[model samples]
Target: MECFRIDESGYTGFDLLNRDQRFQGATAIAIDDEEAARLIREYFPRLQAGELKYRALSRRPGNHPRLLALLAELLRAHKSVTYVCDKRFLLILMFCDYAVEPYYYERGCNFYEDGQNYGMASLLATAGPTLLGKSEFEAMLAAFQRATKEKTPAALKDLVRAAQKTKWRELPEAIGPLAQYAAPECLSAIATEGVTTDAALVVLQSLITRMEVMSDGPYRVEHDQSKNLATYHDLLCRFIGHEEEIELRQSEIASFKFPLKLTEVVQVDSKASPAVQLADVMIGAALEAANVMTGLRADGLDPEKLMPLYAEDQFIHLIPSVDFAEQKQFRRGTQAAEVIDYFAANFGPKK
Candidate 1:
């Protein structure tokens, strides 16, 4: 069976609102053991006796070309995929999915049926920070994070309080309701059900989905050893033909979708696995490129310079994309223009 080596970058657990590491990424590469060693020996010859770490190599001047060359060689030789997450955007999605949608669902509304959820999330992520003020926006996310982490009614109430305090009147119509009716019980249910907002798991799921599509049959995964390995192992088990129901509310039961095909998942040391080391390099470069593109980090590396090496097909991002219809909804002088302007400046096709 085919084996895919995986490694992650910017792992801040479920803390999606982390300011320092604003993005998380994972890369999976499918290559033979011999070929992986060969590429490492050719391009990264100095690291032949040591582990290949992207951060260390990237810190030195004149190594950028070598890293890019190595990545290009790997992409040309192997089937590789990278999944990136805008962590703050992910928190916004969770807010819409867990808090907002469940409240509306209990009122006989399908928040996700017509892609309204995505639209709302896009608006909130882009404009919420500016409208609510950075402190308030961050407080709202911190409250939700505490609610999910603490899994207590009090913590849930704190989230509700934060929501109630949001300046929703100054924001879009789509986001106003969240402040008024975000259900504490629904938020509590997410925590009680042990649902995680981990970007790593999100990346793993997407990678597995793509890998399944690429594979003709069952495949194995070798991941860099991480503290969350046990959690990853359990999640992988559930993915293999397991079904569960999530209690979104007292009256609402949502069936969880498990779209994964797998045989095994093993966590190995990076020093021992050349493929995992390569995956580490791939994910680090990809995450840095994204951070530079989004203005999350100023690492002196020009994103446009790396655009040619950063193939669109090789990377998958969890960031939301608002359509033109949605963009036009925001009038020229309205508060919604903040959303439009943010997207126009930060997102879309990078030229």
Candidate 2:
């Protein structure tokens, strides 16, 4: 379950075939023990992002007997020969999802897509800092110096234009039969390393789209009823000490079973505004009734007796019986009814 962020750099490869082999389009590449370690570092960060788990060889470099033996064999076979072991190719190795595929060594050819490919540059661009690569202040300074040398005293706007124009030189040149692959938006260089060309393009596209629809200020909705539910929940917490025990029902998950000690009940409205009052009134009446049910004799209104007012199903209990312990345990449920009734009687519509 351990995670690691690895940095891939400082790896070299040697070829097993001679220059004659390369001329005939034949080449062999092999990695040494040191190079394997470097590949692990490079792929580590990407592996963590994909939620992978693996024991790192570098952590127990001495204990990696199999890896060491493999490297030793390859070294012996290619003694005095060289292979171009491209660690850049190893960058994709970090994306192995062990949960889905456990055999990392024998996994066949890793496929890559030109359009859907994501890389480090794109990751950074979407989640990067305010500034990238060279500092803005430094860019300004260089532009100023170049303008001065040109003897034109360029304006601030013109200097900015020059800087942007300079970035166009980083694009890769088109080559071979696909010479037309030289795209206008192709990324030759980016502020981040180890990112693919297409990934950089995605980041650039996202930036452009975001800039197009930037917002300027805050906005509010005048007729939001969602706020009323929150206030009702708050009132329940105040009356009943079991703030955590009260469960607020949502439209989709409205039906639920209550324990034998609990019941579904309601408070009645006896005041001015019944229809539109957000909080339930019947529950309040039941709470007031519970106080009397407990033999406390406060106006002789038994909240437990009032339980029938809201109970819909026999199994879904809303009120507790009149025993001293039950009364103490169900006091919150009782008070819940009382609070709703008290508030509604003073403010709800006339019965």
Candidate 3:
């Protein structure tokens, strides 16, 4: 009897190479229909009449205090989960796709290689054509050829050259359907849109897992409809596994823990959906907190103070990786820096 509505924001580009692109994220607010109606009735009057957006309602100087109050209320509630990403970490999934492959298992994270040799270029070279198609794929490889004539980290020059020559005859039967469906635009979105779509999937996976322990019976999910996002979400759900039942070895997410069974997924406009609107606000606040601390050179806000503004032990997780960073030990000062510093020192250095 639980319904979760999804919303997202702060994505301007899907190109993985655009490191300067702003933070991208998605949020979901879970509630029953009655609760959704109650929330909309109580808050809609106070919000700007058009759309209850975080950027409009929270960012304007005049609205800052109201925005803060909204964020405070979001923290007080336990129904929301957010995934806000660092651009660099998301780009590195491409690298992960390479390092973890069968051909490169030996080069995967190890004592000496430390996973540096696995760059996104390898993944793109191998799989980019499946998404980007021949012409665009060739153009992308041409760009790589220019930047990395002699010094490509993952030794992607061979793959890039191969990708330029990729043909239907070369592609495996596994990729036939994708090759048939993928167009230039969809391929282009795989980067920027992938961040939000992937994060949303994680949220769905985690939330459903939590729901299994807290409730019983069926669940319904609603999302403010964006065609690309909806496409990604639905695709993951159908192909990956059931919300409640997943094969142990084949599971994309390791910690299944039995998410509440999802009976349906609905797509609706945000203007018509209270849960989606509220999810938008929460997602906005979460991404904004990260942006305030790490983005906006002028803000220079304290990262530690950011967590307490929400409910005790509940707050936005500004993660720099595909996997969520466990922040229970997130203390102020040096410790806060260390969370990211550890990844920076070990994983791909910032940018």
Candidate 4:
């Protein structure tokens, strides 16, 4: 049976506001074991025995060129898919979905389907710091994150109180309605079934969907062993060959009906699997490229320069939207617009 190897980078496990690791990325490669070993032998000859870790290798001198070369060759020779998620932006998305969207939904509106969720999330992610004070904004997000994990009435109430205490009167006109509509009941209903904001699951879902489309028949997956392996296994089982519906407050919120071509999902040791090691390198390069694009890491090689090596559809990025160039002329709106423009110009799908 055909099998793909998978690995991930920058996992902070629901801590979307982690200061050091802001992006999470995963990669899947369809190369066979023999081919992966041959490529590793050719490009990374210095590594004699252990698994190839991009983080450690990247810190060493003269390894940048080798890493870039390996990535370029892998993209050129094999079928691969990459997914990257901006964790902070993901937190904004979760807040809009859980805290804000349900209020509108009860009134016969769907923010997600209508793209308003992205719009509001982009606004908050970009301009919230200036309007609400960076500390306040982060504290609100931290509260939401905690409430999501705890899933208790007290935690949900705290999230609502955080929103209620925001100084929305001094903010822009656009944010006024959002503040008014921020309902505690919305978060309560969402917390009923437990909220999950893990970016790894998001990345895995995207990568698996893309891989299914790329493959001719059912394929299995071999992933690098990690603490979240059981969770990953459960997620894969939930959707493989079946339609799954996600419900919020007993209402059908989202549905995944795609016929999965996945047969099995198993975790393997990277030290024993060249394919998984290659996946590690691919994901590391992708994450480093994103960090460089966002100015988080300045000294690494920019893999965006190697965009031409892969197919246009090979990479899927679940980052914040940069399409808010025409926001209102208020101070926060203008600041949001500038941030959006910068991201739109710097990082996104290269046409």
Task: List TM-score per model, in order.
Answer: 0.82, 0.15, 0.57, 0.83
Superior candidate under lDDT, 1 versus 3: 1
lDDT of 2 by residue, 1-351 (tens): 111011111111111112221110001112233443443344342333221111232233343343334333332432111111112122211111110111211344221111111232222223222332334323433443333224242433344453343322332110100112221111111111222211111111222122112212211101112332232223222323222233322112121111112111122221221211111112222223333454533453333433433312101111212243433333322222222223333322223
| Candidate 1 lDDT over residue span 40-105, tens digit each | 889877764488888888887578878878888787767778888888888887777666666666
Per-residue lDDT for 207 in model 2?
20
What's each prediction's clash count? 0, 40, 3, 0
Q: Worst 10-residue stretch by lDDT in candidate 1?
A: 246-255
**How accurate locally is residue 26 in candidate 4, as Cα lDDT from 0 to 100?**
83
Candidate 1's TM-score: 0.82
Model 3 regions more than 4 Å off = 11-14, 32-48, 97-217, 236-254, 257-260, 297-306, 310-351
Model 4 RMSD in Å is 8.6
Error of 2 at 240 (Å): 25
Candidate 4 at residue 40, lDDT?
A: 84
- Candidate that would win on TM-score: 4
| Per-residue alpha-carbon lDDT of candidate 4 for residues 1-351, written as tens digits (9 for 90 to 100) | 788898878888778889898898888889888899999889888785588788788877588878878888888778889888889999888777767665766778645443556678887888888877777678778888888878888877676667656665555333333456556556664574435666656666577667876788889988867775555655666556344332121102212224566878887777889999889888887888788888998867665665566687688776666575332111221222222223233322234
lDDT of each: 0.68, 0.24, 0.46, 0.70
What is the Cα-based lDDT of residue 119 in candidate 3? 28
The most accurate candidate by lDDT is 4
Could you tell me how far off, in angstroms, the CA of residue 99 lies in candidate 3 after the best superposition?
A: 4.1
